[model samples]
Target: MSCGYLLQMDERPTLDDIRRAPKVLLHDHLDGGLRPATIVDLARENGYEGLPTTDPDSLGAWFAEMSNSGSLERYLETFSHTVGVMQTTEALTRVAYECAEDLAKDGVVYAEVRYAPELHTAEGLSLDQVVEAVLEGFAQGGRDFGIRVGALVTAMRHQARSMEIAELAVRYRDAGVVGFDIAGAEAGYPPTRHLDAFEYLQRENAHFTIHAGEGFGLPSIWQAIQWCGADRLGHGVRIIDDIEAGDPPVLGRLAAYVRDKRIPLEMCPTSNIQTGAAKSIAEHPIGLLRDLGFRVTVNTDNRLMSGTSLSEEFAKLVEAFGYGWDELQWFTVNAMKSAFVSFPERLELINGVIKPGFAQLKWRGARPVA
Candidate 1:
């Protein structure tokens, strides 16, 4: 008996379909996704004249171009401007608010947007104040736009404030903060350096993800999971290095452990390409990871830097792999399941929003293929 699944899977999803499909984002950076116009306005208001261009279009292009340098340091340098203008309370709130609104418009039903609070304290705002401002903005934006935005309080790995940030994250757990993370250059500044923070979160039963396996290699991934006990791996594209493609792909000890443990990998395809983690979207390790039944989730590491959204990421995947609604739904569900939100809330979204959203699109373009 024909199951009819192949018929619906025959046609590729269009951009519209991709946009309307309910999406979940796990690794987006708040400082990395500001509106170019907002950056310009904030820069001028703050009397900061460091922007490469005052023109919004040109500034946006410049951010993308600078990020495409294939050097993690250069890609990170783009944040100096975004973080520069976000020191004040008003600026932080506005940026947070708009981040939620933009994600809602792109059909991201749930997102755990992260930012390093330490980076926003240049103008004397305390870490607590910065967290409160961003939380307020996320609350307002969520109420207005009908999307759930959970803030991940991040500590720069190179800095000495991971424990402080982890405490801040726990303090705001009930308010809006969902988890904790350490983000920045992964090479010299390993996750082990922030061992105190990870240990604290673990003791407090708070969830956290470590930025690993992007700029670095398996050692980074291994330490994040084994030593630090990250709940998820941010930009874990380098985990691909351990898997040797064969008739039946052979997984090294680390790879095998990751798959066996069902550790969630937040794979950001375009951002990986931009940072030299992957050659291109078509050759991204996400494809192989998904095929191997690893718990993989799609993400926009930085929408502004990669010039991408959750919908755009899914659209690119479809274009590269010819995925249909079912595949998209699978990825969405995987993200929803891996989210730091409470189990009941995750179930609510999976059943209430995501499943129904994709079901409507599943048969829209299906036709019999000879």
Candidate 2:
């Protein structure tokens, strides 16, 4: 487990060092992380020839470029191709399998990959079938690749099927679905619109995260926590808007409440930049949030779209904020602690896997001072 090269004197950890470090991902879109080649093959098999490019490399570049348009709507439009080829059960299983494999290769020890099951019913697959296929793929991937994968069944915020999706999530809670979520543009369709689904999840003692404070501002975050009772805030980058980074750094009521409650903020740095939530990684609120003791967890919102992996995200933070092994370990532990999995399982992974993994890396040498 020890990467000796990372122990070199006077050296900041390299990308390879970050790759070798264990990671925990709490927020990633299933449809948004498909391999470009998989998309091409699935499209060919399904005879859906609407792809911008037949070549996988070009297709991958196209997705990155489209998602970098600085408009959340334009970024989301890139999903049409991914979702188009993911309608069939085989395709769903394959995509889910590859997602786990890719994350494992990048050193993600644990991940909760989420997708809106309603988006894949075009081929007549039931919501339950969609969940089952994805679960089967994750189970297979875990057996093959030594990584634990959990499914988060998401409902689109702009749609009216939140209650049904919530029901689907509760129904499959013991069958591999770890939690429920709502994703989409956060402006016009607030998390409050799905209050019934949130309330239902609360009643069932289920866990759920809300897509808030990304494309919108403080009001969106306030409503997600105050109104809907979100367990975590998805891309809660907008909380930065309420913080005054002056002498002693004053936090607004909403930001203070989020911090006081220790609600995890699933911050996706690259995706936030792509959506214009943060001007740059150097300017990201995650640095301040971490400094201020907020429960912050780093994530990859969409690997394919952002052209990033969990390792790459960690590397970016290292470069931007001069973070080192200790900072990296802090983020990883935060994510593992915030996972929706059972407390005993979470503790086992933290003690047996994540802690040991970081200890090996730290044993390599002293981390550079942050």
Candidate 3:
């Protein structure tokens, strides 16, 4: 299991080095990580031609550009094309299967992909049908690739169907749906708008995460956790704003509570920069938060938009924050600990998958670093 080149001396670290480092992904989006070639083919097959470029590479770049315009609403527009082609069961299954294969290849042992079922029902599939197709794809992919996958059925913040989506997620809990989430614009559509759904989820003993502190600020995060009962905070990057850099920055009440409670922060470094949530990757507060004992996990919010994979995200963190195998392993464990999967299953992943992977990755030979 020892790759002689596991540690590239003096190069920082690289995707290759980290690719063998077991990781867990908690915040990836299904419609946000479609293969460029698949999108092109899907679009062509469905006779829907609205893409800026037909070529796979060019279309990939187009999605990235469209998502980088500094406006959350504008960034979400890119998904119109992705979700458009994902309406059919076959397309959804293919995307889900490919998503698992990609994560497996990138060294992720566990992943939970989230998407709003309401958005994919445009082609007449029921919520149950969409969930079934996605689970089928994930199950097949996991069986084929050895990557454990889970689904999060999200309710769009702008919609009034949170209760329905929460029910769908709870209903499929036994069938591989791990949790529920609220996505879309966070500024106007606060988690309070989905209180009923959150309440129902809590009563049903279902786990849920919330999209907060990404587009909005501390108020949004506070409401999501304090009010709506979110288990984790998606891109809770703005919690830093509530912090005061007395000499080296002080965590406010909310930040301190999040840290003390061990609420996981699903931080996507490149995606935060792309969405203007963080000015730069080096300036991201994840390092500080992690240093302060906040459960911080790296993620690819949208691979296509951020032009990043799980390995790439880890490589960037190493380059920017001097993270080594220990820190990388810590992040992986943090993710697994914070995942919505059951306690026994999560522990199994850590002991059986992550620990062994890192044991092999901490090599001293010639692996290339950043």
Tens-place lDDT per residue, model 1, 1-370, is 4445335544688888788888899999999999999999999999988789999999999999999999888899998899999999999999999999999999899999999999988889999999999999999999999999999999999889999999999999999999999998988988999898899999999999999999999999999999999999998898889999898999999999999998999999999999999999899999999999999999999999999998989999999988878788998899999999999999999999999888777766666444
Candidate 3 lDDT at 126 equals 95
Arrange candidates by lDDT, descending.
Answer: 2, 1, 3
Please give, for residues 284-329, the per-residue lDDT of candidate 3 as tens digits: 9998888888999999999987788999999888988988888999
Ranking by TM-score: 1, 2, 3
Q: What TM-score, computed on C-alpha atoms, does each candidate reach?
A: 0.97, 0.96, 0.95
Choose 2 or 3, whichever is better by TM-score.
Answer: 2
Best by TM-score: 1
Candidate 2 C-alpha lDDT tens digits along 243-306? 9979889999888999999999999999999998999999999999999999999999999999
Q: List candidate 3 segments past 4 Å from native.
A: 1-11, 364-370
Clashing pairs in 1: none
The per-prediction CA RMSD against the true structure, in angstroms, equals: 2.1, 3.3, 3.5
